[model samples]
Target: MLLSDQAGQTAATKIPRPATLRESVIEAIQELIVSGQLKPGQHLVESELAELLGVSRQPVREALQQLSGEGWVDLHPGQGAFVHVPTVEEADQLLAVRALLETESARLAALHAGEDGVRRLRALCARGIAAVESDDVEAAVATNSELHAVVTALSGNQVLAELASQVARRVRWYHTPVARRRGMDSWQEHTALIDAIEAGDEDRAAQIMREHTEHTRASYMEQRGSQPVEPAPKPVRRRRPRTSPTD
Candidate 1:
């Protein structure tokens, strides 16, 4: 009887874990992209990723599909998946859409966020600032993403929150490399935005949020080179005529 009870207890303790392989693959790939390891425009080979993660192709495929839906990866009809590299125009369009959604979310949050929501947002911002100060660009990006998510959630609109979250995830790709080079000042804009939110200044918060996202869009374009929407001009420098002393 004692032995059977002990066996039963051991069996109970050995309960099977939940299915997380697909989620793990998704997270690993996202980390690689955001940490600049995978890089923008890089191909995502399932075989290679499966080998690296010791996962089967099925889970990798599922994860890739999910990422593709999230706008993080581009799925080709027959060539397989590659990381999505937004053109300047695509970035501008995404930013414009996000600005409209997020500014309204911020406005709603300023009016509706409870004490707990405010605390969470402030904590996220603190973590983001710390990450920026320590030059941990990836962490800073993640924390900033979390801050926006919290604000959106506080709005209590499920549809808006879902849409904003998806848009923010895509925006994160552009900020990865840029954040490391830009450092804390890259996030300075958030300070005013958060301040306005905390003060319950809905209009100010909305305006600041819009401006912040627009600024990010502009910076991304500037970094890629001016006239980002247009094809780069061919290099043109006039050649100096040779000065020859003629008789």
Candidate 2:
């Protein structure tokens, strides 16, 4: 009878484990950043974020530290955390890296992608175009990112997928603004890339991807202007004013 009671209790009483505070806080913060609710250079007040996430300051602090390590946040020594803003030079570097990685990914995808992969890529491109047509810049950016991610996954290389995902996160910083300006043309480029992939032309796919990334970098630079120029020093005043007073 004791054994029967023990079994009944074991079956009825489920173990209740609490969610990890750090993970919960991290996910909440990440979602806010990704959705553009917490923009670049925005101050991350620990107490405020903790309140919003329904978590303690400890978890929010740890999450911010982790995000800072991931290059998503900037942790000032005394001022606290803020979202990281990528400089024009940093954006250029990220685009270059993406061009290299994604070109190879596209090449591999072209060689390995079957009809199913092609269909998925087409659907992603269509979604991007529809988003742009609807004037949904954020949706367009998200769909575009998803398309590239799908291409990388089709490559069937886990390491490549990880690298592309990292690059894509950084690229998202530039993509949001660019998509707002570029609109449907961005999706048109996606169409060309997918067409190359569907044709099973590895070389063409790589070439197109490289050119697309370079064009995006150039457009971003053009939008932001060139590097900062130091202001010229003030010229010395003539002695005529003092001479007039003396005269």
Candidate 3:
């Protein structure tokens, strides 16, 4: 309980354990889902995933169970595992909560961000803009997240930053699908947010954050409604041979 006792503890306590197979498998599967390689409602076959991931089925199976518990995957009694399909309402609600948390984060960031913090934001915004210009959706999405993270951290509120960090990962997943569509406009919005923060305009920063999150939510809604239903494959007809002509 005392400083002397704490000093007696070896650095060995700080060394982290290596990831177990199951833990690694879970992370891999989560990456696949987050990258959109595993589409929503797509079947997750243990054997196939094991082969793809170069692990045994046991770890894959365990990973699926853990993911299902986390609401990232769905496990059906007869159907095995499938990626969770987020609903319109779910996306809207999640983004709404994100907006609430981040709007305040931006407000505090404006009040607390130093010149160095503003510089970091500007650098990230430049990267984001370049990514959009090059049509690299993935890179743009990553930079966008990094820029927001800087703003959150600059808020000088540890609790709010932590909450934003937790939501940010899920937000990245949802953002990936819409990144290409959001494109230049998203970066331009970032530009505005950075300006507000640099000017120490707390009200304007908060308003920009709210509108930015709202735009993403609206984009998700539009994307959800616009998903095209695939037409069923038609059966090929075989023509009967003319027996008389063949003879």
Q: What overall lDDT goes with each candidate model? A: 0.78, 0.82, 0.88
lDDT of 3 by residue, 1-247 (tens): 8767878685435677899999999989988887788888888899999999999999999999999998888887756788888877778888999999999999999999989999999999999999988988878988988899999999999999999988887788889988999888998999999999999999999999999999998887888789932322333556789777563
What TM-score should be assigned to candidate 2?
0.78
lDDT of 2 by residue, 1-247 (tens): 6877789567656688887879778878876886678877788898899888877799899999999998788877656688877677788888989989999999999999999999999998988888988998788888888998998998888899998887786687677666777776677888999999999999999998888888788877876675332322333445655445563
Q: What is the TM-score of each candidate against the true structure?
A: 0.73, 0.78, 0.84
Per-residue lDDT for 125-199 in model 1, tens only? Answer: 788889977877778888877877888898788999989877776678776646665566656767777777778
Worst 10 residues of 2 by lDDT: 227-236
Model 1 error, position 19 (Å): 4.9
TM-score of 3: 0.84
For model 3, what is the C-alpha lDDT against the true structure? 0.88
Q: How many backbone clashes does candidate 1 have?
A: 0
Sort by TM-score, best first.
Answer: 3, 2, 1
Lowest lDDT 10-residue stretch of candidate 1:
226-235
> Which residue segments of model 1 deviate by more than 4 Å?
1-24, 61-71, 74-81, 226-247
How many clashes show up in model 2?
Answer: 0
